[model samples]
Target chain A: MNITDLDTPTLAADLDVLERNIDGMAQHCQQLGIPLRVHTKTHKVPEIAKLQIDAGSQGITCQKLGEAEVMVDADVDDILIPYNIVGKPKLKRLTALVQRARITVALDSEETAIGISQQAIADGCVVPVIVELDTGSGRCGVQSPQAAQRLAQQIMKMQGIDFQGIMTYPSNVRAKPFIEETLNLLSSDGIPVNIISGGGTGSEAASKEIGCTETRSGSYVYEGMTRVGNSEMLTPERCVLRVIVTVVSTPTPERIIIDGGMKTFTSYPPTPYGHIIEHPDAKIYGMSVEHGHVDVSECSHRFKVGEQLSVIPLHQGMTSNLHDKLVGIRGDQVETTWQIAGRGKVF
Target chain B: MNITDLDTPTLAADLDVLERNIDGMAQHCQQLGIPLRVHTKTHKVPEIAKLQIDAGSQGITCQKLGEAEVMVDADVDDILIPYNIVGKPKLKRLTALVQRARITVALDSEETAIGISQQAIADGCVVPVIVELDTGSGRCGVQSPQAAQRLAQQIMKMQGIDFQGIMTYPSNVRAKPFIEETLNLLSSDGIPVNIISGGGTGSEAASKEIGCTETRSGSYVYEGMTRVGNSEMLTPERCVLRVIVTVVSTPTPERIIIDGGMKTFTSYPPTPYGHIIEHPDAKIYGMSVEHGHVDVSECSHRFKVGEQLSVIPLHQGMTSNLHDKLVGIRGDQVETTWQIAGRGKVF
Candidate 1:
């Protein structure tokens, strides 16, 4: 299929750019002597995961059990789920995952660990469990190292569970100090930390400076306008997701409406709807399900109704999940289409 | 499949409540003696559209050509596109749609009218075009009466198009005044107005006061959090769409993590990630792609890992597009499951 033949308001991945992004990030980690565990939550396609693995990634990291299921289905041997897995259905799934490959999950509470242990015992498999420490996102994970040690101690006492290491996704600029404090507290109690994992696309450099065994970054593989707005290293072409929006209504001298809105392009960090690829002066002011409000008041040429514009989303990770398939384009030419195999893998 | 058996995270609708909502809206419009043109953009399912049509909606309104295609595929007869259609490919699709049903499209520009005229001429069909007048959403449509008259004049002169009537969405308190002014302007030019369309769920009472011939509202069939938040009459059970999320992690004494994120619920209008159904005290602090941040600090009971929470999203229209299927529930019983056939129909 040609690029133009793709369904309007769809996600298009530049395979060549995606490969460069994967190889570049993997090479950076290799040069730094740190392992790279790329997160699969961004592009849930199995083919993309294969490319990342081929680029020398130590393994793939999944934030959810469903994502891990996809990575495992893709035949990626090593999988690390940096999320606390709970619920009988998910635990049963996780324990079953252990039979096929190396399976490790994050634990932030004793209650969570007990459930994992029971599921592991029932499945007749011992699973490695890591402790998720809340460095700064302040959203999840255990708060203090004391809490970590307490949780880890509880997990160590479990029969079918192995306490592996400590993990934390530190908030921006606090990686070094937070890691040091947590390390001192855990090691002081004589608890060994084997797989200290932390970091994302934004904090990758700071994460490496903290001396963690591995770093996890997802969006770096498909840099977006939001990431590029913050980081200077990302190139626009490296962005794997693009929304092809058609101009629906040009109401005034200043505004043009596009068919792609919040449904097609997700509004995260609440940034402008999207970055207009061809028109630099056009800015997305607001959006609804089927209409995008573009303020092109400053642009010289007017975008007539029915015109299609490719937009790089402010956030790429969540946008791809909005669709079912991704058209893999290699420089204005579509190579093939990949089903977002694990789309809506929120569980 | 039973709604409970669907294995989804948040299934909140009571079948009884949904029926009441649908009936209530239809009855309200029936009592007022105004033709109801329910917008199908919210519930893109053809079954719901059929129900609305069966219950006495004058016709159905679609926001995108893709959605109209789905509705036409389901054999829906009368369809109104409440958006400006432009471009050759889109115009061709609109022209092709003429063979299936009676298609009435909104027009706001002479350029677009000319384009559609050419396509309709080539297709050997006379297209019914409604001039969309900007009442106040400030989003689309012609602002002044003069601009609407000029566009209507062009439509009358076009080879394969007929200026049927005028349309406007209620964005301000003066919608009636704007519609009246546009009608007066067109009549001054000796143009006949047949279908004067306006109104939504929010502006139904106001719409009747404005006295348009038809009113289009989609959210009334399936109430959402946004409508519930603003409406004095609706309840959570009346809401037809919800994101079923599982507690992935309980990070702190205060916060509980759920597996539904922006992908499951669109964060338009920037409300807290989601509203907990039974737990009103819980505020969704933040969200990642597949995880939700629930602030449970004020709650007495700790949310055990793996527990399911039903989160009511702010916008129901966009949330309906996030999933492929919807299961209608009556208490704990699954009544029916409908495919969101219009999911991602953003072309």
Candidate 2:
């Protein structure tokens, strides 16, 4: 099948670029002596997870248990969920999941720790937990190194839960002091720090510099923006996935409408919705629920109603969740189709 | 099952409020002497479409052929696709779809008309087409009243195509003069204009006042905001659909983290991500991919981990596309679960 011959508003990923990104990140991590835990939240496809592991990723990280369940069903081993698992319903599911694979979770509060510890003990399974520290990003974590050490101490005393190292998101310089102080406190008490996980799109080198044993990187698989020792940058050529949309209506000389909209693209990165591969001069000025308003007044190209344009969505992770399957294309030919099975698994 | 017992970050619609909204819109349209064609984009559930049809809707409107196919497979009868159908792949699907049920498509260009007409002719099907006028929306439409007549004349000359009347989104005061002038011009050419369809969430009364025979409304089933002769208004009690989420972490006294975030909710109305029912004084200040940053600085009540809250998304239609099922609830008990079967059908 040819790429251009498919239906409009279709999600097509460049297989060449995908391989390049996978190989690039795996090599970068291997050289830095830090294991890369490919975060499955970006592509949400188990096939991509296999590719990352084949490229030497140590393991995979999931944002929720629902996604981890999908991966476990696919025979992928070693999963890490970096969010607090709260409530009885999730606890029951967590107990069932730990029986199937190597499961690890994160915690920032004693209440979260108690819930998981009780569930793990009752299910006759041991669960590994990492203390989450705030560093600087004030989303979900303990405030200071002392607070993290306290949480780690409580987790260590639990019978069924093993206290791993620590993890924080978007590894930055602020995490350096906090992680170093907490590591000193834990080691002095004779506690093992097996895993120190940290990562983001442009913060891989920082994750290694801040003393992380593993980095959970998700966006690097598709959008291809990495700042690990200048390994990769945010370039159009680095982006693997492209949304193929056709020109549906030309309301005026200054405006044209594509079939993809807020449902296909996203409002993340706020301005300049997408990067049009065919017409870089064309500005995607606005978007409705089902319409992509494009500004082509400055472009010399005269777009027809049936002509197709490829758009690389600014935020590929959010956009991947909107579609069911992704078409893998190699040079104008369709190679494979991967179902985004982990989408909408927010449970 | 009780609503509180369900998993965290579940999409639930209040059955009583859903019925109140459905009945209110049906009664309002009954008094106005206009047929109501429910737009299925808001809910994208076949059961909700059936409810709207049972409540005196003439038919339903789908934004894309993919959604129209889902409705057709579920035995939905009349569907109006108020967008142009271009490209051969979509044209083939549209031909097969028109064979199953009554499918009406809208067109604003001669190229789009020729493409659909050719495919319909090859498949031996008569496709109903409506002339899309601008009406100040600046999205997808013919520029002026004269341009509408010219497109209608061209469409009338095409084979395997029936020229239905006209349809415009967001029926406003600006649509009055354009629709009236086009009606005169189209009628003088001895062309019968049978359907004058115009609609939006808060523009149904304007649709009737501007001489529309039927209005397409979809948000009334869930969000419950309408302006059909003051039939309803935007209020907390009016919103039928509520996204039930749980507080996973309280990082600070002033801040709490909900499990729902950009992937669960959306960045659509741009400010105040969601209206928290439990914490009325609380503000949803920010959103990450899997965490909703909530500001409870002004709230008198204290929040705890594992506590649940109800949130009505500002843009329910966009948020509806993010989930797979809509749980129907009556007070505290779960009534039914409807698959969002028509979601992500943006073909």
Candidate 3:
């Protein structure tokens, strides 16, 4: 099927570009001697996860049990959830996930581990636990290396828990001291760290430099390199996904309203919400609830009603969370339509 | 059936608040002697549209054919798609929609009208068309009152098209001149204007004052009055829906990470993404891709891991678009769970 035949305000993934992105990330991680564990949060498609694994990724990482459940159903093995599995409901799902596949979780607090440990004991499964360090990210994880050491020690004593290693987001220089201190502390206690997993799209080498055994990169699978503050490696064409939208109304000589809006593309990374592939000069200055207001005043290109624009959204992860399907297209011809299976799997 | 039993980071709509909001909007429009055409884009639930209709809404407004189709399937009789139904795919769906329900559309250009008229002719149906006026929105609409008159005249001459009236968003005092001038221009040509549709959540009085025969409101059904900059009519408890999230990690004394993040809520209306209800003094300072980073230093209440929080998202519509289900609850008991059938229906 042709992409033009599909409905407007749809997601179109350039298959060739997608393949390149997946291969490039895998190769980059491999060259660094760190196995690539692709983060499936960006695309959330089971097929794409399999594609990353096929491209030589060691495993896949999911933030939610619901996402992991979808990946497991599709036979995409070796899933790790880098999140504190808190509450009884998530613990129940986490324990169930351990029975199906090799499920590992990341946590900062002993309360989170205890909840999982109890649920794992009841479900009769050993869930691998990773101590998440703050590393100056200040989002989630223990504030200090001593706190990380304490959580790891507690997890080791728990019956249905296996202490994996340490994990932090966007593995950077700030994480160096904490990770090294935690390693020394754990080694002195005779505890082996199997995985010092660090995450980032353009920071895989940094993760390796910081003594990471494996690196988890998500955005790299779909032109996420630029988003991670590394512009030299990323080109516009490398952006695998483009939101296909049509000019629904050329209201004025200066303004053109597209079929897509905040519902289609997210509002983050602020305005110039999307990069219009057809008209490079057009600026998406504002957005209504359901209409993308494009300022075409500066552009020499003439926009007309019914004309289509392939827009590469500023923030792909936020955009991916809004859509249900991702179309794999080679030029105008569509090869496959995959449901964003992990969409709305926030729970 | 208790909300505490339900999974964290899920949408919870207070049934009592939702019903009150429904009744409140219906009463406000009725007191002003203008019919209410509720916009279902905020909730995207068939049942809520039905509830609005039951509470004296004349019809419902959908932004897309997909949303209109969902409402039509749920037996929502009158649906006004306040968008230019451009291209073949949408026009085909639009024509099919006219057969199932009383469908009306708003457009600012002849090209958009021609496409709809052609499809309507082939389908042997009369599709209602409303000439959208700019009225200073600078989004999608004809530039001036004169452009609106031209489009109305063109619609009157088109085959299988019914010229409904003029339409503008966020109806205010500024729309008065454009609406009145357009009404006079159309009257001079002996063309009767039936429905002068104005839209906004808090401006029903303004809509009526601007010669609007009817008004369309979407956000009011979900505590959207405050979002429209009218805080007098809205209360904190009146916010019908709240995103239920759990504190996954209280990483520091100041920072706590909630299970829900951008995927669960939205990034718009800027900082303090969500109004933390449980701890009023607490603030949602930042967000990771999948975790809400909250600053709780100012709060007297001490947060713990596994603690639940009911957060009122700043912009309800953006948050509503990302979810698949809208779980209705009365106090703590689960009342109903409705699929956001019109979600991802931007096409």
Candidate 4:
């Protein structure tokens, strides 16, 4: 059945804008001689990843092992896992992933590195490992370049592990200065920074400016509110991804309700996520499951009760995780629909 | 894999607490002689719904069609869709569900009632629907008794639709008075109100005291902070769900981070979501993707990196939505592992 004809509220993508977004990011990175390793966690679909790779993404970056499995199954080669794979189940999964394709996993501590090393040795496989360096987004990674080198030295001594790179996800513009300082520290310490993988859609350009070889720009391919704010170069991201909703009730002239809420679009606070494409003035006030309350009080008397609206969400990455399928469209025409392969894959 | 033995920072559930919580709610409703229709939207697993029914719930209520589908697949006899289901696809799905079991849907507006009526007519099915009256909670439902009556009249006239009942989700004790007054209006109009479904975990006793025939309480089955504040009768709610997480980093001497964040827990704000079972003073300040930062900056240095702590979440319903599997344990011993059958079910 056609998505527009379906009886549910959804986020529909505009293809013309989406192609421009994908091609625009690739052209910018190619002009700067940086390999675009689009993060699969954003779209989390192999088709979109394939489109990015076909457009010149050197490879794909996965945040979870389950996501990596999706990318591998989609037949996309070169995968970079930027998460510290903790425990035996994940290690076994990571080691097996290395056997199928060229997999590079991140590590910030000797304990996790030792675990990864042990798994690689047991599998009789040489898995490439990168020491995650903390630049700014102080979520994970070693604090200093000295720590990175120390971890790398330990990995070099360990059997069946290749210390291939130094990676860091910086806090936006700090990608340039922070990475430069770290690169200088590593070189001075006689540590080889072969991969130098750092950069998200927010900091992709800055990382390239500072001599990083690869940039992971996942949201750019689909173009969420964050990516739209970060990249002024890309045309307003229009892809086939949108939340399609029909107005169910108008309790008052100001308060109209739609059948899409927090369940459809996870939490993107301060600004009620997903822009109403049909009604520019209509702002989504709050959402519960099966209902999105739009404060059309400003545009009161303008909205009809049964009108359907398409929304551009504030955060596209997490919203994609909420659904099982994406109805890919070309312009106003429905082209294809793909299951969000490996969706809800918490493991 | 054994949940406790697993290496990753995980969210472990306590079965001992779960069973006690189930029995507590069942007994509370039984004492009042009110039908306990547990909202499966909180748990989303059919196994839990079955357990709730087995514990003495009259039926199960689902927020979405997808959730209802999961329950129906698990052979849940009676299901209530508390939200207005729109669109041709969803309506068709709802019609198909009637063949399997008893289904009652909620409707707030005449337009939605018409849409459902049209779909039900097309499928040659007479679906029972309840007019959602707004007692409080300012979300979905008809505001005034006059509006409720008009909608009821429209529903009665609509083809292939039966206006069997009137329902409301009351926000507080004020709802008791408000709903009782409204039901009087409906009865005076000679409207047959078979099921006067009102009350949530927040207004359970007031719902019964105010004369609602059926009270829908979901969170009380696995009670959390929201229900705990509203209903004092549920004490063992603390025992059902526990988020088990491992400390990943100690960024500073004062701040410690756990490896479960927005991915493991829904980012519903207000306060730190859960109480750290191991650490009393520690409060979850905020969370990124893989790290939940706990601030213990003021007092002691009790917890180091890699320590495991189980947290009792402030909101158990949404917390259950984030995980793929439910690890049911009885006094640290896992009894059964059930798939979150309706995990990302956004229909």
**Candidate 2 vs candidate 3: which has greater DockQ?**
3
TM-score of every candidate: 0.90, 0.96, 0.97, 0.92
Q: What is the per-residue lDDT of model 1 for residues A1-347, given as tens digits with 9 covering 90 to 100?
A: 55665547768887787888898898888887778888888888889888888888788888778778877887888989887776666778889999988888887888789998998898899999898888777767887767777887788789889988888785245656666777787788787888888778766666677778888888888888667774233335667667777777778889998877777777665546677778867888887666788999899996777677888887787788787888888777888889998886766
Compare candidates 3 and 4 on DockQ and give the better one: 3
| Chain A TM-score from candidate 4 | 0.91
**Root mean square deviation (Cα) for candidate 3:** 1.9
Chain B fold agreement for model 2, TM-score: 0.95
Q: Which regions in candidate 4 have their CA more than 4 angstroms from the true location? A: A1-3, A171-191, A229-240, A300-306, B7-11, B171-173, B176-184, B228-239, B248-257, B271-273, B295-307
The recovered share of true contacts, given per candidate in order, is: 0.68, 0.82, 0.88, 0.37
- Rank candidates by DockQ, best first: 3, 2, 1, 4
lDDT of 3 by residue, A1-347 (tens): 88888888999899999998888888887788888899999999999999999989888999898999999999977998998888888888888878888888888898988898888889898898898888887788888888888888888999988998999888997789989999999999999999999988888988988999889899877774337444333345778878999999998788999988888888775567777877778888888778999999999989999998898887787788888899999988999999999998999
On TM-score, the leading prediction is 3
Number of the top-ranking candidate, with lDDT as the measure: 2
lDDT winner between candidates 2 and 3: 2
Q: Residue-wise lDDT of candidate 2 within B29-118, one digit each (tens)? A: 888887899999999999999998999999999999999999999999899999999999999999999999999999999999999999
Provide the lDDT at A324 for model 3. 89
- Model 3, residue B29: distance off in Å is 1.4
lDDT of 1 by residue, B1-347 (tens): 43333444543455676678778888998887778899998888898889888888888999888889999999998999987777667888999997789999998888788988999999998889898888778788887888888888888888999889988886235776677787788888899999888867866666677767888887877776667674322346566656666776776678888877766776665546566776777888776666677888789877877677666777777777777777777765677778889887777
TM-score of chain B of each: 0.92, 0.95, 0.95, 0.90
lDDT at residue B214 of model 1 (Cα atoms):
87
